[model samples]
Target: MMTEQRVELAVTKSELGARLQTSESQVAELKRENEAQAVDLSAMEDRSNSTELQLQEHKTVMEELKSTVEGLKGHIAERPKVAFSAALTDAGSVGPFNTDITLIYTKVITNIGNHYSPATGIFTAPMRGVYYFTFICHNYGANIRFGSLLYKNGERIVSMTDWQTSTDHDDNGSNAAVLQLEVGIRSTCVSHLTARSMMTVIITAPSAASCSSPCEQKTLQHLQRLPALPHVSRRPCSTFSGFLLFPM
Candidate 1:
């Protein structure tokens, strides 16, 4: 009986040792899992911080862009207004040509704004604005077919047709247009008339205080040489004129 009891007590002690070993291993596994979770959470926090900084930088850049845009708008608004007027003096007998030709004006009545170029017969807009333009052609030759056109760039925008007056009377007419012109825009007058006819064209527009291009100075220099002749004509005369109506 004593030997059986001693055997039972030894078995019980061995079983208790095994249970303790299992508990110790489970505790070590739990500790390792907690350490891995901590590392993962720390990495997630770092990424979130970087993303927030980038967002802040982008916002700053957007604000700067907005400011620059506003400044440009203000500068454009402050640009000067534009106005010009011109008229033609005696362009001796023109166009005895076999084919159609463009007449160039050598005389100008007024070029207050300096936008009109007598050299090229083109009016360049100094700024974007609504403008009024008028062109008149008077021919003193019977049996003459006289016509005029207003051109934008190289294309014909409008045409003023020829009017035949009675025998021994001058054939004269005028055409006018109100244009919404743009900055850096160009316009001109061209004439197609019969041979040996004395025709005069006149152009007029309101003058602006300042122009946006350096051509304004050249306009002044040319204006100085233009002989201030009296247009004391009882008969119809040719004229061209324009002015800024308003800005767009």
Candidate 2:
């Protein structure tokens, strides 16, 4: 009986030892899993921070672009207004085509609030397209030939002559002329009419035309003021005005 008891005790002790070994292996595996989870968490945090920084940079760039656009709008809104006027001489004959009776006077009259000086008033052409030009001349009863000429860059583009006036006593004749020009060109009108005569000229962009590369469209608005002139006893004379329009 004592030997049997000893064998039973030894077997029980061996079983207990094996069970403890198994529990220790399980605990080691759980510790390794926890360590792996910690590494994964650290990696995820790093990526999140990088993404946040990138988003902030993009947001800042967007804000700067918005500010630039607003500043450009304000500058355009503050542009100055352009205005002009002219007067005729008293008691003079207009012309027989190259006659000295035609007198021309030009003046710049800007608004008090938004005034532009002549030095800065001249605008550069914004495109390389075609432009349309027109001139009109009105003659009172001077019986003299009346005409108007358009000049571009100091060169004549078109000249109009009165077809109704045949003699020096002819009255109430009017003339008009039209021409086409290239963009980036500067021009003016010359009036060859008697005293108390009036003339008007206009230059505008051509439809279906495109601007040159790296150029932008400019804004143009008409503002005019007529200057008073002395009364002439010859014929009732007409008045004059001028205008220019930008990119087509």
Candidate 3:
């Protein structure tokens, strides 16, 4: 009986040792897995920080873009609307005298912004915008060349010429233009004329006064519609007019 017991005890001790070895192997594997997980967690944290930085940069750029757009909106809103036009009021005429002179429109048919002065024969811009101008001219068939020009800021933009080609007929012509004008820019109609007696023209406005060139003279810009006419003058013949299309 004592021998049998010793053999059983030895067997039991052997089994216990095998179990401890298996447990140690499993512990070692668990330790290695834990270390790898720690490494992965550190890398993930770095990536998370980088992603956060990118988000912050994007947010800053968006903010700047928003500010620029707002500034543009404000600028557009601040721009003003402007328009104006004028024409003849009565019958009139200028020179048969041989002299180049600017036509001053003393009578105003319409001055929307009061920017055009019949006295100066010029339209002064109140705001930056695109403008349209028109002029009509006529002459007494007194063997004279009837001519007119559109002037912008003292520069010639266009003109109309009507020569009494037929002694039996009165001469007439018209011209137009579209101009981009800024504040302080002035526009007017200049009359180019040849010798004759009285000339009469009509429209929303006048015929023209002869103008001298380089086209820059300030006062000699436009013409009067109604001539300070002679008794039985051709009633009304031409017009000088303009209007704003939109703000530039």
Strongest candidate by lDDT:
3
What's model 1's lDDT at 242? 71
* TM-score, prediction 3: 0.49
| Tens-digit per-residue lDDT, 1-248, candidate 3 | 99999999989899988999999999999999999999999999999999999999999999999999999899867755454444433544344233444556655667766877878676666777777777655544433444555554344556555444434345556677777766676665544433332222211122221121111111111233222221113334555667778886
C-alpha lDDT of residue 15 in model 3 = 92
- For model 2, residues 1-248, the per-residue Cα lDDT tens digits are 99999999999989989989988998998889989988988988898898899899889988999998899889667543323333233344333222122233222332232221234322233333333333333443332333454444434445454433324333332233332334444333333323423232322223321111000001001112122222332322433233333223
Off by over 4 Å in 2: 1-5, 79-149, 157-248
Write down the RMSD of all candidates, one decimal each: 13.7, 12.9, 9.4
What TM-score does each of the candidates earn?
0.46, 0.39, 0.49
- Which of the predicted structures, 2 or 3, would earn the higher TM-score when compared with the native? 3
Worst 10 residues of 2 by lDDT: 212-221
RMSD of 1: 13.7
Tens-place lDDT per residue, model 1, 49-105, is: 988998898999999989998998897677555666555435333333333333344
